[model samples]
Target: MIDIQYSAEVRAAKNDGTPIVALESTIITHGMPYPQNIEVAAQVEQDIRDAGAVPATIAVIDGRLRVGLEPDQLKDLGQAQGVAKISRADMAACIASGGTGATTVAATMIAAHFAGIEVFATGGIGGVHRGAETSFDISADLHELAQTPVTVVAAGAKAILDLAKTLEVLETLGVPVIAHGQDEFPAFWSAKSPFATPLRMDTAEQIAKAHATRRALGLPGGQLVANPIPLADQIPSEELDPIIASAQQDAEAHRITGKAVTPYLLQRIYERTEGRSLIANIALVRNNARLAAGIAKALKAQAG
Candidate 1:
């Protein structure tokens, strides 16, 4: 079995059976610049803590699958150059090759489950990219959600994706896409999208019960809690529509495809919105962290 290195805080939490929420590391390494990346990472972790749960920020550091990072490690990772943005496909290779890598949504879910964590918080998930009919650019996150059995809390799929198609694929996969406290599926930076959710749970307790119920029934997958960004913090769908279209046009013009598509489109959107998209992203992520912490607590209570 592969040896997992848990941070001192996470180790203690595990020993005491404290509820823990897993966080992905790509946001630190690839989401923004040095100090700010670290700052936001720390803030999200603290958010989990304030909500009565521990945070396990998973990453591969020098070939080790670290379940949680030390503050120093977090700082170094934030400033580290060329840290590979890894997912299910490349995570093992990076570890085997003794490389440093940041975990994306799929990889984080895999790691979280392996580390016995049932909940994870992230800003957004990748999904059916636009033009998937031809480019066939679907994300591994959907498949991971179908098999990993770790609950993921996100604002929703990133706004740049084809929201309707993403939901359709999740439905086809038999993954429960439960929107938290709302009927409409959230759109990352925006609180509501055009698509309605297939499922909606009003409280973390309800969501947690569903999670446990799935496990008891021998289900093979996790749940997606589409936690909406607070209305005051959201960018609003109407305002983002034209900006998203312009960004997509730019992406096509630049021929950005495959894994490069998301970052490129996000950068374009950031530029167009004068960084407000990023501000909303940070807000939504922290909100998700808080909500995931609640779910973790509820799950833990159920287990007890």
Candidate 2:
């Protein structure tokens, strides 16, 4: 009934019981410009393959849920205009209407679970907005993690979000926020945040075991693997804080509200930072892909 279609590689991987990592499509359709978006997406997919797992970039094309995209499909998605940012709430509607859309973190997790994939790689997860208490503008991604059963690997919540509130919400939802190889939680473009992670994991095997243990204990939700951006590529918290503040102010000045806020802020930051933020974003995404692949491989090995 889901009407899901898989790429040849994804289908083969599924049939063979091989490791496969789920990737969200927003990074292509909404995160960056065309050509570069497609190129970076392809590179991330290739990173998973190089690490011994298949990549399934989830999206809805013409109302059908696609587990993996072909090269042409990826290109089209990158170039398409006015693509809907589909989350759990809108994914079904998009499919029902036969619409073309890109999956966000929440939608990607749902699709991955439906496809029996356990690990997802992304640049970062959405979280509590800076003024969420008053605006009630929290992302559905938080609640999605509370119920979904897929492990998510990312640099961390976007720097533009209220990291403290995001971590608090995750804690309340009983989701494990495991920082990979560090005690401090990452802040997307920055390698570290001021807050400490609830849990720390040193290796992919440990993170994989934590995921398996959660399932064994009948835990209701997935785990957040907060892998930090490589130190070399990081912009540092001190440098990014002021830049983020300026971008946030710009968004408020422009009256950008709701979903428009994130893209507006990111675009402003990208310009303010002279494209360094985008470079760091692409690097972190590749880093996440590599880690997710390892975690997927470990999960498969454990199953066997």
Model 1 clash pairs? none
Q: TM-score for every candidate vs. truth?
A: 0.99, 0.99
- Report lDDT (Cα) of residue 262, candidate 2: 88
Q: How much is 288 displaced in model 1, in angstroms? A: 0.3
Clashes of 1: 0
1-304, model 2: which lDDT tens digit per residue?
A: 8878999999999999989999999999988877899999999999999999999999999999999999999999999998999998899999999899899999999999999999999999999999988998888999999999999999999999999999999999998999999999999999999999989999999999999999999988899999999999999999989999999988888899988898899999999899999999999999999999999999989888
Question: lDDT (CA) for every model shown?
Answer: 0.95, 0.95
Worst 10 residues of 2 by lDDT: 27-36
Tens digits of lDDT, candidate 1, 1-304: 6779999999999999999999999999999988999999999999999999999999999999999999999999998998999999999999999999999999999999999999999999999998999999999999999999999999999999999999999999999999999999999999999899999999999999999999999999999999999999999899999999998998889888787888898998999899999999999999999999999999999988
Superposition TM-score, candidate 2 onto the true structure: 0.99
Model 2 misplacement above 4 A: none
Position 183, candidate 2: lDDT: 99
